[model samples]
Target chain A: MKRTASPSFAIYTPDSSLRQPLRLVGAMFRDLSSGRELAWRLAVRDISAQYRQAALGLLWAFALPVANALIWLFANASGVVLIRDTEMPYPNYVFTGTMLWAIFLEAANAPLQLTTAAKPMLAKINFPREAIIVSGIYQTLFNAAIKVVVLLPALLFLGVQPSGYLFLLPVAVMTLVFAGTAVGLFLTPVGLLYTDIGKTFPLAMQFMMYLTPVVFPIPAQGIAATIFRINPVTPLIQTARAWLTGSLGTDLVAFGLVNLGTVLVLFLMWVIYRAAMPILIEKMSAS
Target chain B: MSDPLIKVENVSKKFCRSLKRSLWYGMQDLGSELLGRRHGDNSQLRTDEFWAVRDVNFELGRGECLGLIGRNGAGKTTLLRMLNGLIKPDTGRIEMRGRVGALIALGAGFNPVLTGRENVYINAAVLGLTKAETGRHFDEIVAFAELEAAIDSPVQTYSSGMTVRLGFAIATTLQPEILILDEVLAVGDANFRHKCYHRINKLMTDAAVILVSHNMDAIAQTASSLALMDGGAMTVFHEPVEGIAAYHDANAQRQATTSDGGTTHQCYAPVVAAEVRILPAEVGYQGQLTVEAEITCDADLPEILISFTATNAYEQAVMCWHSSRHPSPLGLCKGRQLLRFSVAPLLLDNGSYHWNFKITRRGSLEHVVWLTRHGPLVVKSRHRTLGNIPYLPDASQCEHRMLTSP
Candidate 1:
């Protein structure tokens, strides 16, 4: 049989992919495009399977943020802790904060979770590995969409009027996703190799939430305020919350800067992931 | 043959013995990869490291199947993984052209919580088929797997056989240009297995196929050439029969060395010495084939039954004879005894056959002595038949008449 026009072929060698920067990037882009359909299929499969067995179904997506908001509301209302005054009602403030935080957390955890789940497939099949990462992004977007839909209705229920900047809310939420997915993709290689990263990741995210303006307002002139100002998540969360609540307290410049840095880091980590996967798969299969 | 579709050159891979060290080395390799530094001098092994596959080279063109036969841990899987591009070789290069499909693990990406229909789509996607493509083939896959009734049921609810059937159906329907099958046919019932072989034979005509299996029958049926891998090294055989023979010879040698102390069960009535002689070394069809055995018994067993079994090259017992089934049972005294077993018309096809002798107590059926003699008595036939056993009627008794004209 004659060879097909533009027959697909691949060469595997010990030479580092980094040695061929242009080709590596080209292949990455190619795989990214080709992997889109697969990503959608996997995402659909995962989402269907995930909710199929759940008794509460989509409510589970709201469970974490709602529970978080209630705990803080209880703490504030019961005088167990004193929180500073905010421009909006404390309930609105904490609820929006917790919802956006959940989006960020889910985005950050998606890559590792999906990749770890697909380890067996990755070791056996030779399809574009980038599909897993794309699938993770798809799932995160699906989850973030759910939270945003819930947040918009809840904001109106809490007496906050929809503002003209409501369209910008998606942008802010996507920036948060970008930053979170970047961190997650960066940690995925090591996280897959070691349980230490997967174990300590949630704890670190929890601690980071405290440093960010998640539930409580940023403190007034203290070490806590300095940490909040310096934390990259601070601008993302503050911007998202401000846009959601229709407030003019958005940190546009810092958000832009953080997103720019995030794109660069995300791309770099993607390359690292592509380079490290074969080695990781080899080791994983050996064990 | 057309230009080679798969070319592998001096490919080798190393593995670490200790898990901890393996992880550590993995990290180091990742670091080097990230730094854009080529693997420096990986030909030498570090501490606790050994070569899993070493210096293996072969090229395969279209319409050829290479049967890779090896013992466990001989690196057949490692080599296949490299060829499939799941992992990279540490010291060599592999060039694979066309779409390569690997049935390394059936139902590899299957999620048990999902229905069979859902998993089929997901598995097809993972194997590089678009959703539209999968949709087109969905009904055929379901029909082939015979899961039309339970296609909507979760895969976890399906039996292992059902799942494997679904997996095999989806994997084979893609019709890739290069197919790698690793013991995937070693499952399912006899009927399904036959169907799978038929499908594989159809796929082999246009694809460059690499099959890794321990079953000699499978290799003999599918492969045009063979590769014998032992201890990370490979020896290529142009002929499938020669490769099967080498594999059997290697296995026999290994068994012989391992069983140096003998496989005798208890100290009861043991056969001290035995010799088996075939009357005619090369027997033709419908000829008299006789097996005579001279036995030296250490103890008297008055009611022992002796049985002789002839096994073919595929390790299938083709024929057996038992003294207990005869008009009178045979016994062993405390001395040398000669026993002769004969078949007036051997109906076995052309192949090599080995003999197995067993002596058991008549009533209790307790094994008195058991021995396997690898005589490999040759059977030659001018008339070739499709199956193992051929029907050879007496010349005067057999008559044929054509009822219809073509």
Candidate 2:
């Protein structure tokens, strides 16, 4: 038997009293970030399990976008006989929007859930909280990459040439990805606290769909439509549409600025969740 | 000077319920109550808002296994969580000087869809074990769980016993510096239970285990110093056995004073515990023949069936049960009753046997009142074994079968 070290009591005071909310936010961030790495490990399992025995393999990722684009095409064709009209090819129009929408939907959603999903990890080990959020982000990004790759072949099949605006798709996609994720991150504390936020999230997302400019066009002069433009995803979907169609919108700068603006909002939300996440987690896990 | 491994000072935690505590707390809401009540959300708290665990203070020297003993909801688990940094008390603070490894939830991270191998790593990672650390320890954990080949199978395929085994193995294997356990070693069979106790003793060399359990016997056996939590504060912290005595004292006191039927919450069927007893039987004979059982139970109008069997230390039954059945619509009542079970002719070989006590409906033999266990009854039947055997009606009536050349 060997005694390594004798006990010495130190009276070092811990600066534990930072405004409760801020302290909570800081802890939340740490938990999320550390949790993100842990989540990455878990998501690797989730991703593999999702596609492992599927017949279509990785085609599972692109299948949604393809199905959506086909629905758009079929609807547009049926419109003439049904006495409704669309001038430009609606299939291409929906494809452009679907590309960005798919990424936003995936990224925003993955983090919105399992605030309690990370409960075991939080309770068992201490890690940064963002790890869980970022793991969700990575999973979404994986799906987004699939959607992006599928875009190229479709663009060629549609006889569309690459326009200068095509270069902007990545930038716009990045904005949607980050902005959606940030909103999801912002909801973490509330989700963990009330759980109402999680259970009711699908309903809220459905309402948000109407506000976003995915299905309909927003005329430049409309005041109501302008408000919708501020919805982070507006410019993201708009930019992707303009690029894929080889036609540039008049508000490329406004669109780019809006896309950039979401980063700040996302960052602020990140800070809030980072700060609030820990205390809420502490509350969540207290026996 | 080296710092002690943990610091918990003046930490207090309380849970506030949603205005449903009692009809009495509402009387404090009038003009008289206004002078007593605080502002805003504090009033929303009612009297239940503050489960005052105030000014509680303690520190853990490195490698100190502090035992926390308490009644249900005594803030023992709450304190353990705080030490592990799982919860922050509204007042005061707790600081751990080393990596905290706690089992807040034993099977919390196990995914039913994943194989046991996958869950072990996932759960280990959550408990701060890196990939390499988990890899090195994985085989040992699987072997310890006695699920070597079964590790590859999904956890859902395993029985509840297997699930608890795997969870216990995974949680215990992580080399925690400050280990916190909450009533998780309360499962497993007798031999495995002994094995776990030994493993826990070994772990005490490096890590300080802050263990919370309802088993006072285990607390007595394992703990060095005990902290008895009552209400929300530490009412007693002393020797392990002393703390257990205090707990029993508190429990017995609470039992004697209460008269309301509302106190009895957990029971099945129509039977309720109005009385319990343990007594020495043989009012007529002194030491002519020896048998003893320290029985304890709760029952009201219980049609009780009692069974007693003597066995060796291996728990192999050397003789059959001596049973007595309480008659139906019995001469029992809804008040205190003391029943004793001791009879002549100590009837078994030398060793220990546990008295398994159960009370059930004598009619269908289905409805149960309460059940309990007692005594590793020691039998020194060295010369008394033959004298103890009761005469069976037919010792030579049964036929033996042979699978040999017929």
For every model in order, the TM-score on chain A comes to 0.95, 0.78
Residue B82 lDDT (model 1): 88
DockQ of 1: 0.44
Off by over 4 Å in 2: A1-36, A52-69, A80-88, A120-125, A162-171, A243-252, A282-287, B19-48, B260-305, B308-321, B324-342, B345-365, B368-406
Categorize the docking of model 1.
acceptable
Root-mean-square deviation of each candidate, in angstroms?
5.1, 10.3
- Give a tens-digit lDDT track for model 1, residues B191-244: 988888888777778899999888887788889899999988999999998998
Error of 1 at B177 (Å): 1.4
* Native-structure RMSD, model 2: 10.3
Best TM-score goes to which candidate? 1
Tell me what TM-score chain A of model 2 achieves.
0.78
Top-DockQ structure, candidate number: 1
Q: Interface root mean square deviation of every model, in Å?
A: 3.4, 10.0
Model 2 chain B: weakest 10-residue lDDT segment is B280-289
Residue pairs in candidate 1 whose N, alpha carbon or C atoms collide under 3 angstroms: none
Q: Give one digit per residue, the lDDT tens place, for model 2 in B190-227.
A: 87778777776676677666878876656666777788
